[model samples]
Target: MSAHVFLHLCHEVGTSLEVGTRRDIMDIINTLANQMRTNLMMTSGSRREGFRLVESDLDVMYWPNSYRVIWELYQSHYYNNLSKELILCDGSESRPGFTLLYLLSPRLYSELQRACVRMKNRHYISSSKHRQIKCSAESQRSTLHGPCVGRHHGMLGYDLAHCFASDIWPPSASSWIDRSHSWPPSHIVDDIVKRGCHFVAIGHKLEKHEQNEWRISFSLAEQKLVYAMNHFQFLTYGLLKLILNRIINNGLGDDDKLLCSYHMKTAVFWAIQQNIIPQWCPHNLLYSSLTCFKLILKWVYEGICPNFFIPSNNMFLSNIYGEAQNFLFIRLYELYKMGIQSMLETLSITSCNECIDFIRDPSISSCADEDVLFSEADFDIKLFREVDNQGSFSVSNVQKCIQFLHIIEQMIASPLTQNQDIMLQKLTNSVLQNLAFMLPLNTYTQENKLKYRADKISCHFLKFAAKFGCISDVLYLAMYYYKTFRYTEALAIIEVIKVKLSQPYVMHNFNVDEEMYTEAVGGQSWSTKMGQAVAWNIKLNNNILYISELRPEQQSSLQNDVPYLYIPPFVMLYMLEIFAANM
Candidate 1:
């Protein structure tokens, strides 16, 4: 496990696609994506960004753009009143910034459903149900021997991401609401916005519920970040992902979906943000990787993994359980201690599964003997459930809220089905009972403003339930509050939730340690301003100097260490100082 050997291995495994083959693959993927799009009338595009020669396989983002298409169909139903089944509830009127549409008519509903199925079949090439083309032995041959037809090189090897590309800014961006603070460069933000962020279709028990919401993905930004990395940084990331996907995840068990490449990507992002860039040299690659492992382990230990762009969006909100979280933390911590020596051992024992053939020969290989198509659908689709996790209300209340949500969803969609009246009545009755069970008793006097506020909040909740068919938003908002250390505000929001849903929440109370949070975040003026915005929705006053704009004298005042729960201390200081020195 000498430096020479490790470096050589890194070079061997982490090489990018050869010039010709890279071009060919891109052409094939784009052509196939376009064909599917033209034939299906849906948006489809593929980008090869995260692929590493022998280390990683063809990592493509198969964007289905389902929400946009469905949204158009929904608009048609709303304007035409095509069927009684397609009921549209304008949440914008009742609630300021939301909209929900119900699929009521079973016949028309079936049509939309059929369209969705078609989209799934045409774009969602991984699903067993949609693999009707595989029924014939002749069709299977195309997957086997053909130069352009192997799954790995062919169009079929891609992981389909049935996501929606939307122009909406992430809710976490609200932290930068105050004009006084300097945020990520305006140009960068503008570029991200122009490219448009995507939201993947993800939820728990999504099939049974009508409202399957989207989870924001900065994959486009992620690709950019990867590209921006130096050679060592790129190689380090590829190596870490290899360890996580092969050694650690395999050790956990085959069915364990707890850890994945995205988690590793998140760790890398955080590391870069923390000024670990300089540390990611060939000489220190192992150390930098250890830092990444430590960061992820810390997240696992705390049972919270912050989304790099969205501070409030916890990536591990739904996946990590009590036993699982503990096990993963211990395992990762051990790996970090073992360092490169352990990595060398793992690499030696583990099969070299990287796409070496695709890189060296530039020839498409087939997996004809394979019984199953390995896809990321399972991990890619589960959106983090919004739950008031910071001990605001009882977990049972939260669970009840989620249950009531399904009832409300069914109630709303019932009218669109054949048994409209009967189903609606039954669902309505069931919803009322659940609501009664969940909502607080009317105790305030008429003179009390609390009573009126409660009524208003209740109205908003009911309307929202009708729209989205769930109270997950309430949970997510509460979590956001908790993450920002606004415990009181978080509890206040939770109290307004008129449902008894139960789930795991942060047991510990958040202390508004302003200094700690600011230091951890880095960029003094921006950090202070962001804190102010979170505490009180103040206008973003342009009063502070970002690290990039800081003078030598100002650098002395930069918070070098922060105690924020999300990112480690000193990271902010490192980032600020590094930027200042470079500038």
Candidate 2:
């Protein structure tokens, strides 16, 4: 096939991105149609049926109903059967492999690479050249997707060794603690494992040994300490809060719990003794400067210091960049604790409307969702059993089981219902147990729910030991700025989060169901306008937005790239509306 024909075909099949600007639509058709027409294997004697599939179809070959992969080769001008030709020409035929060989089969894999190659010049190819080849190769060599740096963004078939290694709690060092070697116990590991790692251990070629990237020198307490002792106290707090959320959402153990509470106190101790509250954390940062500036900013702006934007992870903000969630940062821990406390008291008091009046804290009173946790004279037996089992079981020790149930219940009661199976039944059977407890006072069966609650509280405490990442501050600050009409400030904060926190958050919630959004939206009833506004304002002033949409775009350029543009659309609409409304 002629080179010109191949180039023409690529124009037709490729997106505007793949085709250079100069080529028009007709050029696309001529190149692709002619190249295939000209290929001897593709041409049947006097005439032949056309190339098998359309451009829209992915390039996977099949045997009737099933997919089949085989190896074959072709030459530019030769029409002879390749097997006999191979003996005559020897390896010197130096022929290119034309994927068109599949055309004879009932189902043919799309030969995208071959078609693209046929086009004129080597450099004219799209950025995705390395990514598109669909075959397994040598262990060290991989398809050319950019380097995986963020806590998120692993290539296809990604894996993290420590994720399910049973040694998750107590580590072998090389397996669990190191960021390069292990992943935090969030959805990231689970997702990577599901994607399949085959065997992704780091290897060395030199005779002399070097440190393994996976090996962690820092203890969990030290990791937490570093979190708390950082320049941004809010970050320490945020980390604590996130860990708490993970504990509550999943489950934690005694060691994990100790890490949570201890790190917080340790952090508080270090910060106070050092007098380390900053006036503000510039949109960019390190540890010490952050705390000093942030504390000072609060004092200057509010005329008084908060007890500290501190909380167990269970009670942290929702979205790190959500405007409505900003209010959450201020006293969210208190509200969450109170919610737990109230749920506990409800179990203790067996009272309903009666409990609402008793919440002394202002934050507790403000949370509308608090009421939703307990309602219905009718108790759900199945849900109760699930919660009970998940909360406290020694052989099973459903640590955060109780808190997880509450979250699940909240998720179920919330917008997550818009989607399917946000929470799995397997999870339900474990965490949510004893439906008798949630039943009405008169109908109660279980005398005490403390075991479940205690286990959950314990687990919530453990999650603190895990590294608390940066999004906590972003959430806190973004929410604060948005609530106060400080749109520009919020945007700036989100940029910092994208730079640092995004990968961590993605790792943590990697396998999380989209249903959580439904839960957050459904149960939490977050305003679409507010969500969008917070998202966009951060985009414009900060020059960071559309990260989701830009994923495919940024991926190809990652070697030389830093994400500068790409904010969520929701943010754009919301900001514009808010700005317009005020004007």
Candidate 3:
């Protein structure tokens, strides 16, 4: 096979355009979901950057909506008389890529005040103190790792970095605008700069008052740049990451972190911007990878890995220098000399021989048949699981649900692609179900006539929910009927639920018989498959609106730390059936 064909095969094995599209869609869905919450707005980081690598970690940066950071004193005028607390970024006392956040607002949140230390008549938020406060509030399982609060155990282990949003672009990174030149285009640059940046609670390693300084994060800009990359560029980036994880960092202890994935990204970014390769195409893919690796090796040798935005900020100063840097340089240099073939061989893709065979024969398909299907199923399962976990009936929850419903309505009224329409329907289903369970709670304290009217309205909402919700969602209506002493009506619903649960394709608690599911609903639309899904557990919010019979169970759950009680669907159904029989 020619080198061009080999590179194309590598692209096929390493990257999926379909997966990238789905990831972008998932990011939008997550962004919409985060908008409903008042406390924090989340932006997904590395994991959602259109990559399907197994080594990718779930990196999320979330900032409070009530706080805003300004890069300059003059920029504060933009938020004059606003309710949000203003924080000024003061880089005079810090490094190039980091600044001390000075609290400009006289009225500060108590938590923010606690994280502030007065120095020279200015109160600066201490990154260390802020991290300490955040860690204290988190569960025991969570530990502070640099700026992020990392939880190591989960379906997808995540690193949550609590950051502050800044609407003004930093002056230090102004040079990046003109530096783009031919690549990324002017529109992409403009959009990225307009979106601004975030300040994470990490200081430059060499800063004297590290705790008082915050690092300016260009994660938003980087994400935009990644999105703007062509397929070949993206595949090359993915390939670099694979090499970083599988080749360079392999068997290295945690303390020996001389090189990181960020270095690889920066190398690629520079390579693209400098036009190191005249063309980025399948034929030139190996050349592209080689150029990036060469750049990284040179940076390591020089002991200066420049930050993409701020060139003066050396990323290698803290860890990648001296003896460590020399060792990394030698290792990378050896690999660079061995060339692209060595790097390709080190990739942990399934069966090297199979990849080689596929490359030799043009007729052999290199793509996985079930890649798209599995990706869709995975996305749906995770999204729905999040909905299930957060389901609650409270005053605040009701308000959020109402807001989310309004957003969904607005989105539905606009023009949408097929995937977007399906996404909105799933969101609508979740919000409607939340409203159904929550809206009637207020009527419990009202007069009998009002309560009767509320019960009727609640039933109507439940019916609407059942249309879009999973199969077990109807059980909410049955539970409501049983609560109202309508045993016959509840029993009828229970019988129907039993029959549905008996189906081999039914999924519950994030578990499904794979063969049965694939045979039954694998080819169906997400909405269609979800309509047949079953809720894993019946969640009852800790509220006084529960039926008298269930109050004991609710009270027991309240004694624990959690704000809700989780009853398996079958368990709840059996208990309700027995109670109805006796009643």
Candidate 4:
């Protein structure tokens, strides 16, 4: 490579090193090997095989292929070069080729990630069955296992230098990164934060003559600047994240998290000035990702993080959901989806979908129509009031709430039964038969809310839920909304209630005629006595229907100690109407 041409490549990759810079560094590194006599033959290609260092990125192919030499090169000279650092690649084994894939700048990376996702899900409809049924005189698997299913295994993006700074790959356990290259930049700090200490110091140490001459204005906060200087090798792409991981995992300081975040945030600002980052990662997508990475972590993991620049979890999700929604980055979207799914399933939260749907919806915005949002400000104010009364919330609390919404939506969309749906249904039915006469109690506080004021809360949320197409919360919330209205809210609630009453539930009903009607022996409010009667019927006939309650010994009073009967809110309401009509 000519001296001028090398400078051009360096410029294209947005770094200071000219062509000779890398060769000088490499020749020295090769000399470090005890057996430096081995001839070094280098071939570069763009194809995803062998070893090719794209643009100015440094990648070299080794004969008698082993990863150990590359590791040695990385461990020895990666920090020293201050030019091209390592971003590992898992080379193709059968093809016997290596390629250095330059990390795409942010917008491009985000764009590519999205493209890959669409590619991944192109066949979902044909891939998944709507429902399953056993074979009708067909051999099971034709004496062969069914074809393996294809799944989407996505890509990770990082800064080359950041990735290669470590001895081993960061996010090794969580990130399915290729191990051949040597650099890393975690867009989300926590993604690689657990491995922070390992890469704490990786930068070009100033030479004696240059030490005094290198007047560094140093923009990022001290900690961020320090971490970024080392991790990013004075690059912008992955500095913020590397710094954040250190703060979060190692603790930025003994007492002050804000101060720590400020320090890092300032460092990012300074790094931006040093390198537009756009040249290497246009749109600063890595930074954008890192910007919300903390919230993304919180949204996905449901916890506050040191990376978020603030420790509060209150609006962390709202902020994260906005970024994920705005960027619509597949990597982020998938994380949020997974997070939401886990959160709701684990928390068993059945409400809040309206809020989630609203937030996740690309159309609605709490920030947009100030008049509308402000008119709704009182609602937020009230919500804050409620927030205030509750104990201080941490990151996990928000995760639980967000997860609850996600799970409810998923269940409504896709109901699963054990390993086998048909077989599971039979088991579910048998359990119903085995444990009837028990009324289920609310497990989460929201479930109790389903019991206590299922009407009001449901009514407020019903329309919005339906608009967002979240039928689960819509139907469930509408039931309570209808039940609790003062004549008007009640009437309004019930109007929508009719549409959702028959959607679906475990204890589905049919005509109850002479077979079900029994002469009543005692005076009871129809709903109460009906509850008890139904409870008894389920216990005797459908054993799986259950309600939990205080044991008689633990009861505050005998009269108040009746075992609760539990049913889906919609189901309970449906039964209540049946009794009224019968009466």
- CA lDDT, candidate 3, residue 583: 89
lDDT of 2 by residue, 1-583 (tens): 1111112222222211211111221122222223322221111100011111121111111111111122223332233333211101111111111011112222123432331222222211111221233223212333322211112112213211210011112211223223322112445333332321111111121212111111111222233222223233333333333333333222544322322332343344435444444431322222332343244324323333222211112121112224423442444344344544332333322234434343443343222221233221111222222121122221122334444545545544544221112122223332232221121222112344754454333233322211121122134334333433556755665565455433321212112223332333333311221121112212111111122333454454444333222244335334533543453
Best by TM-score: 3
Better of 2 and 3 by lDDT: 3
lDDT digits (tens) for residues 158-258 of candidate 3: 78898999877788999999787887899998888888899999887887888788999998888778878876787778778888888888998867767
Cα shift from native, residue 528, model 3 (Å):
4.6
Q: Which of candidates 1 and 2 is the stronger one according to lDDT? A: 1
Question: lDDT (CA) for every model shown?
Answer: 0.41, 0.27, 0.73, 0.27
Where model 1 places Cα greater than 4 Å from the true spot, the runs are 1-6, 15-47, 50-156, 173-189, 204-211, 251-253, 349-583
**Candidate 1's error at 499, in angstroms?**
80
Q: Looking at candidate 1, what is the lDDT of residue 504? A: 20
Summing lDDT over every window of 10 consecutive residues in candidate 3, give the lowest-scoring window.
366-375
Best-matching candidate per lDDT: 3
Give per-model TM-scores: 0.43, 0.17, 0.79, 0.18
lDDT of 1 by residue, 484-558 (tens): 344565566555542222212211112133343334433433212222211111111111221123234243432
